[model samples]
Target: MERLSKATLPAAHTDGVTLPPSGWDTQRTGIVHMGIGAFHRAHQAVYTQDAFAATGDDRWGICGVTQRSDTVKRQLAGQDGLYGVLERAVDHTGVRVVGQVREVLFPAEQNAELMARIVDPATRVITLTVTEKGYRRNGQGGLDLADPAVAADLAGGEPVSAVGRLVRGLQARQRAGAEPITVVCCDNLASNGRVLKRLVDDFCAALGDDDLTAWIASKVTFPCTMVDRIAPATTDADWALGEQILGLHDEGLVTAELFKQWVIEDDFVAERPAWEKAGAQLTDDVEPFENMKLRILNGTHSTLAYAGALRGYPTITRTMADPELAELAAGLITEDVIPVLECPPGEDLPAYGAEVLKRFSNPALAHKTTQIAMDGSQKIPLRLLSTIRDNLAAGRNPAHAITGVAAWMAYVATPEANGLPLPIDDPMADRLAAVRGSKDALGIVENLMGIEDIFGTDLPGNTSVHDQLVDAVTALLP
Candidate 1:
């Protein structure tokens, strides 16, 4: 069987699959994106493709950068950056070929070429989907200099990691005459753009680039964004579904639910795609939307993940089916999360919470519990802890919020029944693993909270928070 590639695209059409129009075939690189994963492809890339189609602007095409490994790059390169996005519905799945990814480059491997593209004047906007951990931020949202990878990047040259590459690209642009650009963060963290901006500034300052920092300050704008799309990892089943339906074998196939959303700050220093034209809401302050999402959607999602994983449910649908996981999610949202959220205009927080549960209950999108459960150490701060801290500050017991954290602790401490360690894919896996070494629930709670980045100094020292977490964790233990 022939593998999917640009050469195979013409003949790749099948009954249920949709091919890119002639317009998709002719797009120029305008935006460069970091982290070419399912979320990026199914959400941002599809939006950009539609934005291009809507505006007839070929210059806004994406040049996706795969930061982790060459897996995505190899997958897309064979397809000439062409891929199919299957919008999975309860009844059926529909596939559309997204071609806005004009090129895919492995940043660490193709350093010079990657730098060249980023520094290119045509690249007016740089967007990132490199999750919360990619920032390597400490408790206070500054660069975690103690991190070995961060320290190595600081000591080295040629722009290695995400921050290094951005700093290097900005430095190049600065040298070539300060070019105005916009850097947007599409990650789920709060105030994401500001977070990335601060990290980049910290990275530059640590490397002693005062002049470059100044230029970046004057010429660049980092727009905070809130993006929502439940694009799960593409399993082999998703792949086979695509092949059986479309008759097109695509290595870069991705899958997502029928719903999509993008809320971006209207702040930009240079020209950006009319993403708003493609069903994205452009606003001035993303705080309300950002907090709503982080607290409600992400908070409960993690709740189901850790708690559901403990129950041995492999995917989200299975978890949501259980009365326990479902109640945990609804209770977390209604009791702990919703009270803290300021409903974005025209949005009812309660109704939104209901809709989120409805989306999670989608039987077709088998979002793996393990996938959402990864990075609990990194995710804990924003997803659960923020709610925990706020409710405590407001003089309410944060017991409901503590359940997710407790579940995480339980999940980490006890592996699957096979004597194999549960797959805890966190940047702080070693730190968490050590925390699990002690079977004491309160001790584990105290240790995890004390981790400055995860809980910050105040929460760990807060006796009430520790008490609540312990109680929550104790309830989960068999």
Candidate 2:
């Protein structure tokens, strides 16, 4: 019944449970990571630890900052920043203890310490996995100065928004004469790094701090990155499984599929981890890889999430087991998305998509459909809308892509599936509440499309797409 920690690690007797290599304790914190969630722990933290183990360089340890709550901090801090990444595949499950996260701090309660870490000269690179809504973007895809949190952050209160914290940290870094740092955005947004830079610029502009803005322009680098890994929300069952395997309670345990990848832009302002040694691809252009993953993997994920949740499939693995739903996902990639994408170098689109489908079918990974279905408004534009827009511009009907969009609409309108309550957990849930009780499919589609933030002005005005959405939503309604 002992909790997994540095002390318990020595008593571990499991055969396949990989421990962090020796000298892990000696590594100093060089990375300040925002949004320290399951995905970051399973993906980037593992890679970072591997980079350290690979080179014996102890300068890449991580200081993980939790954005919204102290739950993750509470989970990992007591464990000495040690956590198990349970890699769940159909045939095999493996656990690896990651130790690169040297410290965990909750920004809400420890903003001053978090800022001090950011100001520290040792913190050379800052990475983020804050989800789409965490950016607090306006409808125009810029920093939402109107947001109360953003306004408060601008007024010199403790920062609430991710951009606010990052910008404030950068301002502090500049004031302390620290070395320039790179900000790597690991979120699932198109042109994520550039988008983050723009958000920071907008924040600076709001403050009218021209000097700090220019300092950022000349000193800091924001690198676009393509990160792929399906780390699901760790359930009680997962914790039990971890205990069964490791003979210890792992509060910070995260479950992911067998696959993991990171493709980062080679642009950095200061020294960075030799991540290429840890199976990360460093390239001059991450756009091709970014777009590929966004469209094929992320787009299909949203589609399956909404559609599968509506059909009462609890998890993505179960959804993929359904013949019809599986085909719908495949068709969305092959018939709609792949046609619009320029294949990345050394990669085949069809093979990549096939692999993505394979990853989704991993039964051991209990990736809940409803979990992925959260924040449809924030996700749709980046995931499904781009494919819809591209196919429409080419004078081709993206029926599968449109189905994905319509599924979101149907999901919003439907309150339950198979007697289970389907909660609409979205930032725009208040605005969507009006359409929830409506029985008219066309009415729902029309109303949702009118929200220019998600669908944009062009899609709503297009009569053809509107008609398609209406029909799709009608068919999807129970």
Q: Pick by TM-score: which candidate is best?
A: 2
Clashing pairs in 1: none
User: Residue 309: error of model 2 in Å?
Assistant: 1.1
Give per-residue CA lDDT, model 1, range 365-471, as digits (tens).
Answer: 98988889888887778888889878887888767688888888888776672332458788888887876545688777777767777776787777776787788
Candidate number of the best lDDT = 2
- Tell me each candidate's TM-score: 0.95, 0.98
Task: For candidate 2, report its TM-score.
Answer: 0.98
Residue 437 accuracy (lDDT) in model 2: 61
> How does candidate 2 score on lDDT?
0.92
Each prediction's whole-model lDDT (CA): 0.84, 0.92
